[model samples]
Target: MVRGKTQMRRIENATSRQVTFSKRRNGLLKKAFELSVLCDAELALIIFSSRGKLYEFSSSSMQATVGRYLRHTRSDQSHHLDQPLPHQHDLQAVQNEAASLLKEIESVEVSKRKLLGESLGTSSYEELQQLEQQLERSLSHIRARKHEVYREQIEQLKEKYDVEEERQQSPTQIQLAEVSPNYGESSSISDVETDLFIGPPKSRSK
Candidate 1:
């Protein structure tokens, strides 16, 4: 029959618990010794009983094994001595970048306020001069833009005037052209003579 799996909980009876501890402790020590012998490995084990008694085993001198372990741990720690911890460096770099960004934001805000003509009480002479220069440049650009717009408007008006003038003169030019061919004809001359009148005969009598 298959054996049942052993329950791992604490044995309730004190005697049974003590017995179990003795059996397990001895079994663990024997296994450690066998493992070291078979693999030619260095090993150590230590156990303490509830009554303050000690059980221990080692493949070599206990002191030597402990000293080797301490040295290994120390070497591991020393290997990283030349560089700062990752977390510390990352946090410090983040703080510095944040501070830099904050300063930049503040500078932009101050410049914006100056442009809007606010918060000028604490401005130095140099700062005020810079602000004045900036404003002058902006005004110059605005004037240049205004002049360009005015020139465009004038050009448009001139074009419109030319077009209207051409429209008004076209009919008169056609009429003059049509009458020019008959200017010196006899009929035209007779019509002009008939339209003319002499002084009245009463004037001659007077």
Candidate 2:
């Protein structure tokens, strides 16, 4: 039978747990030693057991190796030393920003009035021409959009008329309108019936 893979979890039995820990720890240390010697690499391995016992191996002095690692890791951080770290804007910076925004608002308000034909005294001939062109372009776009809306309304009305015409049609109602064909025609007094007076003032009393 094929052997099942060893389950990678905490060993429940105390004796088995201790045995596994000792065997794995020794194997790990041996592997680290072989890796350092065969490849001639600087290596560090630090392990702490459940009982607080320390196991450490370093190719060089542990402190020196750790210090060298720190130096390499922090090399990029050296450039940041002279640069100011990010923080909230101070009072002076906020004031300056507010002043800049106020000036921008004033400029925008002036431009808005100029577009409405209010402020023309300060505008040059070129500025006036530019404004005129801008207004004409805006008007063209507005008119195009208006025409599109008009077409949509016409289509809706056409569809509505078609529906109403269909509703008025029936199997018996051949080529007839919903309203009377001779609805507004007037008949002479002699052709009309006496009881069905068309426009006699006496009908109002009834």
Candidate 3:
């Protein structure tokens, strides 16, 4: 027959309660003895009844077992206390680095504001002079670059003019060569005609 599971509550009758306590206490002690014997374990159990009656079991000396349990718990707590948390140092380092970077960024922002003429009231005369000198140097560099650009442009224009002049005079030179019978035979006529028609070559001035 399948017996229904019993619902546990306090036994209201004092006599029944005492009887149940005696039976369960004996049963628990028997189980503890069996477990120690079967598993060859060091074990201890202790109980006190409502009337202050003591019930106890121990595979070895109860004092020794209790002492060992206390020592084990204390050592575990001490070990945890001694060791640092894994992230503590890393978190501190990251915080320090962040603070340093923040300071650098603020300094750069202040300098940028000064350069933009936004913080002029706070600047000293020496600082103003330094800024003025820096600006003058920058202006000088810009003017030098502008002059270099203009010189390059003029040189390019001069090259283009020389090329066009050569192109235009090429056909005329060819026609003159064909018309003059002694153009290639003798140098006298060619030299005289060159000087008379084109004039002596102009010397370049430094």
TM-score of each: 0.38, 0.43, 0.42
1-206 in candidate 1: lDDT tens per residue?
99999798878999998998999999999999999999999999989998999999999999999999999999988998898899999999999999999999999998899899999999999999999999999999999999999999999999999999978887778998999888779566676433444689786556
Q: Which ten residues in a row have the lowest lDDT in candidate 1?
A: 188-197
Write one digit per residue (lDDT tens) for candidate 2, span 38-60. 99989888999989999999987
Worst 10 residues of 2 by lDDT: 181-190
Top lDDT: which candidate number? 1
lDDT of each residue in 1-206, candidate 3, tens digit only:
99888569888899989998989999999999999999999999999999898889999999999999999999988988977776997998999999999999999998888778888898899999998898889899999999999999999999999999988887778888787986566865556533333445564221
Error of 1 at 61 (Å): 0.2
TM-score result, candidate 2: 0.43
In model 2, residue pairs whose N, Cα or C atoms come closer than 3 Å (at least 3 residues apart or on different chains), thus clashing, are none
Stretches > 4 Å off in candidate 2: 1-31, 46-54, 60-123, 174-206
Rank the candidate models, highest lDDT first.
1, 3, 2
